[model samples]
Target: MTVPTEEVAGAGAPEPSAQPWWRSAVVYAVYPTSFADGNGDRIGDLRGLRERLDYIAGLGADAIWLCPWNPSPMADGGYDVSDYCDINPMLGTLEEARALIEDVHAHGMRLIVDLVANHTSNEHPWFRAALAAPVGSPERERYLFRDGRGAHGELPPNAWISAFGDSGWTRVTEPDGTPGQWYFHTFAPEQPDLDWSREQVRADFDAIMRFWFDLGVDGLRVDAAPAMAKEPGLPDYDLTSYGDPTVFRSSVWVDSPQWDTPGIHEIMRRFRSVAREYGEDRMFVAEAVVSSSQRLADYVRPDELNTAFNFQFLKEPWGPGLRDVIDETLRLHAEVGAPPTWCLSSHDEIRLATRLGRTDTTAVHLVDPATAPTDLELASIFHRSGEWVSLASLPGSWA
Candidate 1:
């Protein structure tokens, strides 16, 4: 697809100084365990993060966005949070988190915590309570549930595929003798999806954010927001080639209503409203992945997230043809009118160095998609994308 560069030329006017520093600041994404090790425990903790604050600050990042350090089963690498209120025992404690935040602030940098509101760890008390509560009970309503035996119940809520290539739903059994029921999880079987349609669920999340916002968090990085809302009827799809269940447990709802759900926007607006109440400016960076640029732009409008990561670069082939992709990248953001957040690499991606041709130039030269090796082109695409894009963790002056 050809992306025009008109939008890049008109992306934004100069920002006023009074605006939040994060809005214009570069960020460094830190995976705690890999960033540094404190106490020589071989795991990254808040204390380790504190000790490395200078390294991060030296990178010239305006802030450090910590991946979920909350207590978790680590089934999906800490995304499955068991306690939003406490730091992971593997990472540190509440006291350490406080110190990390203080240390980050002292370095003239802010902290953006990852809030995976879409789901939580199976070990979480909420999920355990949800398992025991009756279908109509307040606790049960916190999670997505369907009768396991009914015709509609036999299938999951929808056919939406999980990001991880598996059925998002899992059967829940009770300690007492009882029929098993399906619980929705868009990503992993162990990460139960929240029933955002339920009022109590929304309230619980609001309170969860408040618990942290009140603790002085600067912002939040929302994970998989587009999948937050599921279809009400919970439709199913034809089986996949492997004969796996067509319906992913997490989403009973798919494009039936619209690609982007109204409920998702409502929830984001509520989050933003609450963020405004706090003294710090709460910036929302949406991690939305979609095929069409129009669909991606929909997530970053004035009312939704402040910015969304552009995946065009991630999908492009490296070479001179990359100019079109880079141009398109800037153009797409310009059209959205939201400041673009360029991403060459994230946790989910293979390192850029590995993608490029393993040569001295590191695949910097562009190649023709029709003739060049796919890997070489991809490497070049990522290399060029990084040249001008701002990342949460990488140095801004790269390339």
Candidate 2:
């Protein structure tokens, strides 16, 4: 998930480059954990990814964005990282990561890894140590922790709920022997949020990026980036009291403190600087869920992400009228004042084929290509085909 603060050289401080490939590229998203298994362990690994490279290329994609493959406890589907540099043992080894990179390049395709910077798993060493320290200790400061006062005499610093389920804050007093404090986790209790307000936390995250970049990754797909900065006042939220706001997409606190906070842009600038340093054409893609065009524009400033994922297309209701999604995309592009990219599917949601009812094979019909019986030979064959046909003038089939 994440690491603690430590002065790391060659991190955010990087030189700028002229251009990067992501500016005009189409990337295919792949969830490696569910793609295919190579070792027969029912878990996808680097070798499996290698096997599927040709298939991905056949789609006319310029690159592929892989979901998290970092060493983890499988708490949140490998989004929880135990080590920044090592590959998860169940997935594969570091050697496999290197080989995958080489193979991807050989096929003339780029690769992007999903970076979950907002939090780390509770089992992470840094979080473990932070949980044990006193309330005001520096280690505890790396995470969001404060003493509780009411409702069991101890509660989290805020009431913001997690994306998965339950309260975002969890009591970390089991191992530590003292009146415990609550730590903030935006997704799951196992994933504790990092204090980006602290300079050390920012620098620590930058170092993690450098580690992967040096390993030859083309770029990153920033996961949950808008949720990086929590509101400082620890204001009580009305939505958190009733139900999880994530599924309905109703609450503003799901992300964005107010809308277009300068802090979020600064964090992205630091990451963009890293891409420039390598002089490698890298794409910085943001996974933002802001509904309005203006809110979406804030994340994709020319100074920030080159391509931000567009969800307006995926949020449409199915019917004969499909222009609403197209109209929304054009409106968002014009109103938001930024270039946008669209995705038809992601691992977190349902497949479009199933959602659109296009998977019903029983409804498909063949069509006849002949018109006015110009050729009796072809017409006789078509008459004898005995197949379901929708139209009589189509190119391939007849009935």
C-alpha TM-scores of all predictions: 0.80, 0.78
Segments of candidate 2 deviating more than 4 angstroms = 1-20, 174-176, 240-262, 319-328, 331-338, 358-399
Model 1, 1-399: lDDT tens digits are 222223211112112134656556777788887888887888877777898888878766786778888999899989998988888898888877877777777787777888898898999999888887877777877888766645645665555556566566677665576556788777788888888888887788889887776666777888878777765666654545334444332222324322246567788777766665553355677766654566676777776667666665554656676677667656766776666665655676545556554443322212223332335554555456454354343322111
Return the clash pairs for model 2, or none.
1-81
- Top candidate on lDDT is 1
State how far residue 98 of model 1 sits from its true place (Å): 1.3
lDDT of 2 by residue, 1-399 (tens): 121211211223122234444555567777887887888999778889899889877755667888898888989888887777788887799889888887887777777898888888888888888876777888889988876668774766665666665677787664546557887777788888888788888888789888887777878888877777666766665654335443323223334342234477788878777765655355577777665545666676666665666665554544333466556656656564455565655776544443334233121111111211133333344343232122211221100
Name the lDDT value of residue 110 in candidate 2. Answer: 75
For candidate 1, give the lDDT.
0.66
Superposed Cα RMSD, model 1: 8.4
Task: Return the lDDT, model 2, position 13.
Answer: 19
